[model samples]
Every structure is written in C-alpha cells, then in structure tokens.
Target: MTVLEIEYKTLLNQDEFNRLESRLAHVKPITQTNYYFDTSDFVLKAHRMSLRIRTFSDKAELTLKIPQEVGNVEHNQTLLLPEAKEAIKTAILPNGEIKTLLVQKGIPLEELLVLGHLTTIRRESQTSIGLLALDYNQYAGLKDYELELEVLDAEKGKIDFDNFLEQHNIDFKYAKSKVARFTSTLKKNDQ
Candidate 1:
C-alpha cells in the first residue's frame, strides 16, 4: 500500500505535552514499537529514506518513507506476526515493495542491519484541520513529546500547525523525525 502523506511536526515541552494530553483526555493512546533498519554504512540516510517495521498491538507494518516535494511517499506492507518477528530477529526485510525500492536505490540487502528500536505512546484525533497525533516517544535512553498533523496539503497544513501552536501560546520548537532522533541518539551512545 502506498500512502501519500503531508505531515507537519513540532516539538513539545513537558508542560505543553501535559496540557494537550489533558485536553484530549478522551482519546486513548496505543503503544507502538518501531524497529529501524539500515545498511552498516547508512546508505539509506544518504538517500534520505528510511525503513522501519512498526508494531502496534499484534499487527506490524513494514514502511519505507521516501521524501517528496510535498511530504513523503510511504510504501507500506502488512506483515504476518511470524514474518515481522523473523525480520526483526534476523535484521532482514521480507520480500516486498520496500525491499524492491531499496534494492533499486542501491542499498545492499546483505549489509542491512537493525539499527535500533523506539517505543511510542501515541494518541490521535481527527480535527477539522487534519489528523492530529500526540506522541510520547522513548528510545536510546531519551524521551520526548511531539505534535504531528497529517494533512493532504502541505502549505495549508503548515499554516494550520503554526496557528494552532500560536493560539495555544506554544512556541514552535524544531523536531526531527523519530528515525533521525533515534539513530542520532544511538550513534552518540555507541561513541
């Protein structure tokens, strides 16, 4: 499955996170574990692409995100329970759209490795503006909160995200994608 996504993100401080969580207290969060994969040399990073197997509850999805002019093109495949477990344990991606795309990009399948994993407690709500998600993520001994808006239009979404923060008197903080943050933290820890 290919999903065309336009997403905007902002970092949230602890206070902001709590405040928003209170506002959305009616929504429930699902626990998700994300296993990131890359070549030893990080060829995927050089290509500005990422591959991950995300498991929430008993379901797992293998997703490859490729940057686009607007947002990203996500190639997602549903993985059976056993396939997901085997892929994570062996650090190999099962044959699917993601693998084919990676091979096309010249990433060596043999060199691919499981970099690390991140766990996120994520709550989502559908707003008039877009689909809003509040995430508390833990990885590499680090924890952070973020607000993400997934919309169909990038420009409008940006405007809406900025305005939402401004309306709530929240300062916009820079945030990297979960993969970037997780990989960077893991690299520093390895050093």
Candidate 2:
C-alpha cells in the first residue's frame, strides 16, 4: 500500500522527554527494529529516498519513503519472516510492491544492500490534534530521543506542533529522519 504522511518531528532534550512522558497516561513500550538499505554509491540518498524493513515482534514490512511537497510518499509491502531474513542477509528485495516501485524508479535492485539497523523503544498515544510518539532510539553506538506528531493536515499540524513546543518551553531542533542520522553515523565510523 501507498500513503502520504504528514508529520512534525523534533529532537528532545532528556528533560523535555521526561516531562512530556510524565503527563501522559502509563503505557507499555513498543519496540521495533529497522534494517536500513542503500546502494554503496548512495544513489537513494541523492534522491532523498530511503528504504528499510521494519520488524516488530511478529511482523516485518518493507517500506520506501520518497520526499513529497506535503510530507513523504511511503510505499509499503508486507514480508514474511523468512523473506525478511533473506533480504537482510542478501540485500535483495523480495517480489512485492516495494520492489515494483523501485524498479519503476530505476533503482538498481542488485546494488541495494543493508547498511545497518536501529532499535527504538517508543511510547505513543492519540491526542486531539494527532498521534503523539516519543521515541528513544539506539543505533551506531549512539542514542537519542525524539517527539513526533503525525496528523492528516500538514499546515494545521505544523501550527499545533509549534504551539506544543512553545507551551512546553522547548526550542525547535533540526530533526533529521532516522535513516539519515543512522547513515551519517555509519559513514563517520567508516572514516
């Protein structure tokens, strides 16, 4: 399936993360692992595209995200456990919607390879304006926290997100996507 996602995200200081979580009702953490993929030459990065297979406890799904005017166009396809494993080990996508989309975009499947993975512990809840997610992410020997608000309307969501930060006395931070951050760290460590 394909989706257009509109959301606002910001990096959070530890204090901000804790204060925000304290006000929300108690909830169990949802843990997920994302195995990111890219070409050695960074073809996908050049186009601001990202591909990954995200795994929860029992399911895995491959997704390719392309930048769009409002947000991103996400193309997703479900994968069975065996298929997910094989793709990770081989860096070859299984036959699915994600692969079809990549083929149409001229991404060379043979060159797609696993870069690495990130594990996230997330607490999420539905708010009046959107879905609120606070995430603690671990990758490449680094860890950080983030707050994200996903909404249907981009303009309204940005306003709400900004107001939320102001009410909490939190300053905005330039938040890069998980894939971009992870890849950057990976590139750094390789040097």
Candidate 3:
C-alpha cells in the first residue's frame, strides 16, 4: 500500500521533559528501534565516505552514520539514523512512483533543543531484509517487530511472518502489532 505521513521529534532534556510531562496526566519511558540493510554494491557518490558519532538522551544512546551520493528517485531505499534531526526520507521507483518511508509524527517544540544526525546505508543493488522494533524497554510498552524480505516476487510464497519469527528466535506470544501505538498514548499525553 502507498503511504504518506509526517513524523515529529521532541528533543527535550531530561529535566525539561520531566517538567513538561509533569503537567500531563501520565508520563512513561519509551523505546524505539530501527534496523537497516544494504543492497549489494551500494554506493552513494555525492560525497566522500565520512563517519560521525552522536550522543543523545543524556548519554542514553549513541550512533554512527555516514552519508553518500544524491538519491535516485527510482527504486531507491532509504532510512534515517535515529539521531538525525527530524528529517525527511523517501524511496523512488524507475516508473516515476515516489514514496516516503521515514516521517516525523509529532514535534516537541517547547522542550527539545538538540541537533539530530542523519546517515544512509549503501550496498550493491539487490534484494535485502530489514526490521524495526519500537518501545521494547518498558514493562508495558508493547514490543513491535517487522521483518522485510527482499523477495523476487511479492506473491508466490506462503511466507509465514509468525513462523519466521520463531525461526529467528523471536517469541511471538510476546510480540505486539505496533510499538508506535503505545508512544501514540504518550503523544496523547503530550497533547
């Protein structure tokens, strides 16, 4: 299905977020994760390969990401490092179809004051797999997980997402549909 939406990020210091959440009825700890896979021979020519290290959440997390060439509007796969400041990402196909993958859902305007970093994964153009896990840190935070398979045909296979999870050491009974929903509650509190 085609997807279109905006993503929001709030970068408040612990104290600031606490002060903000205090006014709200409920405040909770949340966890989010994103996994990226590169196609074979992935190369971006716009800039030389460079490395940058970022620290956020008051030494809570750290990440390293690199940037490359300008993106191809057709058949391009892209993802943003969690540290990147509320940025926009899209994938384009050769047939002139465009899609946005990473979007900001809500922006923490009054509480946040930090710069985010961005990075691109590169590999040879081929089929690849990826997954995203969100808000798994808390006891009540539902653990969301999705696996992406670079199948030659989207049809033609009886791929079982649950079975696949079992094979990969994921206990399905503990999994949830979307971790974002719990954060959605946090967003509600933000409102």
Candidate 4:
C-alpha cells in the first residue's frame, strides 16, 4: 500500500513530554521498534528516502518513504518474521512492492544494510484536523520526545500543530526523523 504522509514534527524535552502525557491521560500508548536500513554509502539518504522494518507485538511491516512535493509518499508491505530475518541476513531489501519501487528508482536492493534501531512509546489521538501523536523515542542510549501531526491537509495541520504548541507553552524546534538522528549520532561517535 502507498500513502501520502502529510505530517509536521517537532522535538520536545522530558518535562514537556511529561506535561503533554498528563494532558493525554485518556489515550493508550503502544510500543514498537523500528529498524532502519540504507546502502553502505547511504544511497537512500542521498535520494531523500528511508526504509525501515517496524516490529510491534503482533505484527511487522517493511516500509519505504520517498519524498514528494508536499509530503513523503510511503509504501508499506506486511512481513512475516522469517522473511524479515532473511532479508536482514542477506542485507537485501525486502521482497515486495518496496523492493520493486526501489529497483524502479535505480537503487540497488542488494546493497541495503541495517543502519540502526529506535524504540518508541507512542500515543495517538484523532482530532478534527488530523492525527496527533506524542512519541518518546530511544536509540543508541539517547532519548527524546516528539510531537507529530499527520493530516490530509498540510496547511490546516500546520496551523493546528502551531496552535497546540502555543496553547501548551512548549518551546520546541523542528526535529529530524529518528533514522536521521541515529545516523548522525553514529557518525559523531565514530569520529
């Protein structure tokens, strides 16, 4: 399945996340781990794309995200644990639409490799404007909080997200994706 993901994201500190969590006492949270992949030379990142296998308690999915004019277009495919393991073992892209899409875009599927993993505890709420999520993510011993709003209308979603921040008096700046942050930290540690 393919979807146009329209979302705005921002970073939050621990105190801000705690405050927001208290306000969202009614929402249930889910925990998941995301294992990110890219070529040795970071071909996917060079193309402004990302690939990951997300594992929840009961299911797993392989996803590819390609940048679009308005938002990222995500392609997702369900995977069995064995299949995911096979792909990881071979350092190959998962076999399905995601692989076909990458081949179509001139990315060599055989070169894909695991970058790292991030685990997140997330709670979501549906609003008139879109889906709002509060996320606490950890990777490579680093942890952070984030707010994400995914909507059908980008302009309206931005307005809603901005208003929410102001209403809470939370001082947040724009945040990069988990994969990006993890890779940056890895690079810094290597140096």
TM-scores of the candidates in the order shown: 0.97, 0.95, 0.24, 0.94
Query: In order, what is each prediction's RMSD in angstroms?
Result: 1.0, 1.2, 17.3, 1.3
| lDDT (tens digit, per residue) of candidate 2 on 1-191 | 99998899999999998898787649778999999998999888987899999988888999999999889999999988788888999998989788888889899989988999999999999999899999999999999999999999988999999999999888899799999889989878889
lDDT score at residue 81, model 3, on the 0-100 scale: 48
When 1 and 4 are scored with lDDT, the better candidate is 1
Please say which candidate is ahead in TM-score: 1 or 3. Answer: 1
lDDT of 3 by residue, 1-191 (tens): 22221111122233433343344324333333332211122221112211112223332221112222321112222333432323212211111111122112122212222211222111111122222111212213332222222332223211443344445444333322122333244446558
lDDT of every model, 2 decimals: 0.91, 0.91, 0.25, 0.88
The regions of model 1 sitting more than 4 angstroms off are: none
State which candidate, 3 or 4, has the greater TM-score.
4
Per-residue CA lDDT of model 1 for 76-181, tens digit only, reads 9999878998999998889988888888888888898999899999999999999999999999888999999999888888999989999877889998999999
Task: Supply candidate 2's per-residue lDDT for 6.
Answer: 89
TM-score of 4: 0.94
Cα deviation of 174, candidate 3, in Å: 9.0
Model 3 TM: 0.24
Query: Per-residue lDDT of 105-154 in model 4, one digit per residue for the tens?
Result: 99977778888889999999997768889999999999999999899988
lDDT of 1 at 85: 88
